[model samples]
Target: MQQMQVYARVITQLIASEDHTVQDLNSAISAVLRLNNINKSESPQHLKRVAHYSRLIATNCADTYSLSEEWIEHLYLFAPLHDIGKVFLPEKLLTKPGPLSPQEFERMKTHTLKGRDIIDHMIDSFGYKDHLHYTGMLRNIVTHHHETIDGKGYPYGLKGDEIPLEARIVAVADILDAMLTKRVYKEAWSMDKTLKELQKLSGSKLEPEFIGILASHKQELMNIRTASAE
Candidate 1:
């Protein structure tokens, strides 16, 4: 218990500080999650890659949309936590080799709210008043990352501008990574196929503007994917 408290303190400090490097903070968070055996099937490197892609998408969207640099930085830092909800999923579901049963799928979907609950609990316990902006944004992003632009997404079926831009950016990054990365139940799709699919989803499943940014920077995004693999 004492050791756990010490570690929690360190994590809280790292997250709250503006000057802490994102790489260091992410490393610490991943370490804790790994120690808890939450990521039994997925490689830690996969999460790192997703983080990279999400940040890239966020940065690109920020530039294209004329968002403040500070806002973009916050989005980049909080984007990884979008899937931190997966930590709440049972290892069996997370590592399952076959497609999930409807019941299992429903259970898996709760990770979004579960992640929000976890962050909310942390804020309540730690009294992280000032970090509210970052934490609040992250919580929303985590809960809504799976949501689509056309109201097909789960949890809340927000459409178009109804979804926050941060969530919209993450939705694109998340889908891209999921499609390109090999998984237990399916083989990886080619980048061309993945981009084509994303294009198909534009205006309906994804924001057209965000998709445009992704389309324009296809090579850079691929480089992030390749570099993270090594």
Candidate 2:
């Protein structure tokens, strides 16, 4: 524990003052996860695109939420960490070619809690001690990205403004990225189909304001998708 504390302090000292340093930190953690095969089933580009998409959405919608520039920067940096807890999940479940059974779905939901717990452990162990101003934003993104505006989402049934604005932005980014990315269970969805699905989910499963924002930005979204694929 003492050695770990020393390691944590060094990391904190090095990156504590700059938000951009968190990008390096995030990438290093992602590399570690990849080396250990924790992210083998996931695309390396998926996280990057989510970060990009979250920034795009949040940047465009900042005025609506009165979001600060710092907050949006944090959203871009930490959006990729939303699924970090999937490291604890069995790879078999992540790569399953069919829909998860009821029991499996329950296990899947636990990732939200697990993600929050993992961050809590890091903060405590690394002696970060709240000096990390954006830790709260990171935690919200990790723990609540799956939550819905209609009180049906898990980890917490938070609705409307009850959900952190950061989480809502990341949630939109995540859903859109997942739709366009191919997986064992589903083919990549076309831009038109994905937008229609987002329309279907608007206000019910996703934040209505964000859906409205994306509705007008179809061409820009296609550009993002094209860039990510290249």
Candidate 3:
């Protein structure tokens, strides 16, 4: 309990301190997750890649999305936190060897809402008051990222543009990385295969525009993978 209080204080310091840089924020996120026992083998790299992919898509589609530089940077910072609630889930559930049972899947779906609650609790408890500014974007990314474009997603059936732009962007980033990375239940898919899979999901499960934007930056994505690989 005392250690948790210390962690909470560190989070407060990281958020409220003006001297803290992005790297500091990243390190704090990593340390927190490590303490919580996420999949140490792949979680960090997955987070880094999603952050990079999100920033890449946001920067490339800036004019269309009306994304400012500040927004893009914040997306990179918060993208990793999108799955923070996974720490609240069980290890067996997270690393299940195959398809989730119906009950398990329902439980899994709660992570998004749980993530939102965690962020809110942290902000309220620690008084991070718009930490780095635009904290709502973080909440949006954490909560709505799972909502599909076709109104088929969980927690809320938010459809079409009803989903926040930040959430859409994070969703695309997340799906791309998840498809490319090998997990306990699946092998790492080839980049070509991953793109094809994303293409299939473009209109229904994900925003098509961001997927197209991601596809256009294949080379840079490769560089990101190389740099962020576990």
The number of residue pairs in model 2 that clash at the backbone is: 0
Look at candidate 2 and give me any clashing residue pairs.
none
Pairs that clash in candidate 3: none
Q: How far is candidate 2 from the true structure (C-alpha RMSD, Å)?
A: 3.1
Model 3, 10-35: lDDT tens per residue? Answer: 55565566566777887887887886
* Tens-digit per-residue lDDT, 100-214, candidate 2: 9999999989988877776766688766766777888877988999999998898889998899888998899889988988888899998888888998999888987788777
Q: List all candidate RMSDs to the true structure.
A: 2.8, 3.1, 2.2
- Give Cα distance to truth, residue 197, candidate 3, Å: 0.8
Rank list by TM-score: 3, 2, 1
**Candidate with best lDDT:** 3
Error of 2 at 181 (Å): 1.3
Residue ranges of candidate 1 with Cα displaced over 4 Å: 1-11, 131-133
Deviation from native of the Cα of residue 31 in model 1, angstroms? 0.9
Assess every candidate by TM-score: 0.88, 0.89, 0.92
Instruction: Give the TM-score comparing model 1 with the true structure, all chains together.
Output: 0.88
